[model samples]
Target: MTPTVQSLDHLVLTVADLNVTLAFYTEVLGMRAERFTPADGSQRWALRFGSQKINLHQAGAEFLPKAARPTTGSADLCFLSDTPLADWQAHLDALKISPEEGPVRRSGAEGPILSLYLRDPDGTLIELSNRL
Candidate 1:
């Protein structure tokens, strides 16, 4: 039998500052901050948008079975936007967050994507794109 990879449901991000990370995702990127309690009686945080989420693990306090070398500023993530890239740029500009790169052409999983690249507080390269 062959095992197949279905899709991405979530990923973990180890962060230095929880509040700053939360604010960047929730306030700046329009994700929702949510708190969840695992069966082990521990509280955890996640940033939810659409059907996907990023679980936030505090540095030095990550849960069991984490990445081998979990560290801040190690993630380069891309998000597909429902809105136009120009509007996303405006949103970023209004927040006074300057992009490190462009709204240029890039190849995405589905098709061609027009993208803007920026860094989160953790220095993770965040790509916001719209499929063309």
Candidate 2:
């Protein structure tokens, strides 16, 4: 019998600057930043949202045996938002982060959604969306 996979637990990201990435996720996207020391005695950082998280590893100072082809600006991730799309737009405006593209319609994991696109400090494309 084959085993079935469950939901995502976390994702690892190699960032050019840890502080800049942390600031963008926490300040702009409103995620929680956490620090941890793994068994290897290496310091690690992550941004938590609800039940999911994205681990951060500095580009030049990554853990041994990382992704085979880890590079900055390589990730494109989408996040679901509970708030209204208009509110999200306003928040982005107040923060002065321009939207690369969106409030466009897009198909999500569950159903149809309205998505707003932007880039993080590392040039990773981020999509913020709300269910339609």
Candidate 3:
């Protein structure tokens, strides 16, 4: 038998404010929303980020007793770009993204990783890193 392999299709995140999240993804992150639709005709919305995506379901579903609220800091998500760290920093500057910190070197990563830490509209921490 052989192990079947597949690429990561997407990542789903539940957000409290769909509009804010969508704006951040589009404006700050410079990602296009490939799809947007309301599920069940409510506040729930689906947003796509490149190949990954996040579903912002309304707060009151049976499974979700509460809406997906923002966290104190940071999401467990990391996005890598082919652009060099210096170039990424310039991009951020051009967009006025205002990173909390970094374009600093990450030691434990496999190679020379330049990273910038920032928060999304939901206060979800995001790390943008590139291997040099």
Candidate 4:
């Protein structure tokens, strides 16, 4: 028997402000919004990040409790960069997105990679990595 295998399609996050989340995903993270359906009559919204499409729906309060917030950490979303750390760091700086400082060296990642950690609008941790 073979186990099921699938690539990550998209991650849906419950956001307080849809515009803010969209801005952060596009302006800050460099993802383009492929399409957007106004919340007038629909209950689902679709956003494109590269080739991936994320579905966003209005969630009720109490979805993310204080106790569950920290435990979720910042690994919910990840993106790989062709540029190295120096260039990526400058990109983040240009956007005024100050990421938490962590180790900077070659590690056994997908390859010789540099990793940086940052948080999204909804407090979701995002990993930006580059392969050497």
Candidate 5:
């Protein structure tokens, strides 16, 4: 028998500026930014949505057990929303954010999804999607 994998809880994002990272996630993507004190007695920031979260680490001050080579602007992540794609487009339009490419169909982890591609302040590719 093999161990069964359930789901993801969190991942980490190495950022250059904590304030900018927190703001982008919380304001642009509609995520919530939170601070927590871990066992090490240090405060850390995280961006959370639904049941998932992404811990933020300063590029030069990361926690132990980090990636072998952590770098900013290296991650390409996709996020899902219950809101329709058209609504997402409007939201982006209101924000004055341009899409690199999008309103295109792609295969999601579960099924089909329509997505919009954009870049964050750190140049990380961020995908906003709707499950179809």
Candidate 6:
């Protein structure tokens, strides 16, 4: 019998600049930032959003045994937001970050959603969506 897979816990992101990425995630996107030193003695950072998190490894400073093809601008992640898409658009406007595409209707894990797409500091595609 196959074991059922639950929700995602975390994922790793390889970034070009840690500080810029952290600022975007914490200040603009409003996620919580955390720093830690792993067993390999390398310091790493993560941004926590709701129950999930994204661990950040600097481009050339990754801990051993990481993704074989970790690259900047490779992630395209969608995050569910409690705020309405209109409000999120205003928030992005206030932050001076332009949306790449959307308030477009799209399919989500649970149901139909309206999403706003933008790029992070390292050009990772980020989608902020609200359930319809």
The model with the greatest TM-score is 1
Better of 1 and 2 by TM-score: 1
Better of 1 and 3 by lDDT: 1
Query: CA lDDT of each candidate?
Result: 0.94, 0.92, 0.66, 0.65, 0.92, 0.90
Better candidate number, 2 or 6, judged by TM-score: 2
Q: What RMSD value applies to candidate 5?
A: 0.9
CA lDDT for candidate 4: 0.65
Q: Which stretches of candidate 2 lie over 4 Å from their true place?
A: none
So what's the TM-score on candidate 1? Answer: 0.97
- Candidate 1 lDDT over 25-131, as tens digits, reads 99888999999998999999999999998999999999998999999999999999989988988998999999988989999999999999999999999999999
lDDT, residue 113, candidate 4: 65
Where does candidate 6 stray beyond 4 Å?
A: none
lDDT of 3 at 27: 78
Clashing pairs in model 3? 74-125, 75-125
lDDT per residue (tens digit) for residues 1-132 in model 5:
999989998999999999999888887899999999999998999998998989999999999989999999999999999988788788888999889998899999999999999999999999989989
What does candidate 4's lDDT look like per residue over 12-95, in tens digits? 566666677778878876777655544454345557766787655444532222224422223356567776767767888998
Candidate 3 lDDT score relative to the true structure? 0.66
Off by over 4 Å in 3: 1-7, 36-44, 58-74, 107-112
Cα lDDT for residue 40, candidate 4: 55
Note the clash tally of each candidate.
Answer: 0, 0, 2, 1, 0, 0
Worst 10 residues of 3 by lDDT: 58-67
Candidate 6 lDDT = 0.90
- Judge candidate 5 at residue 19 and give its lDDT: 99
Clashing pairs in 4: 74-125
Per-residue error (Å), model 3, residue 88: 2.8
> Which one wins on lDDT?
1
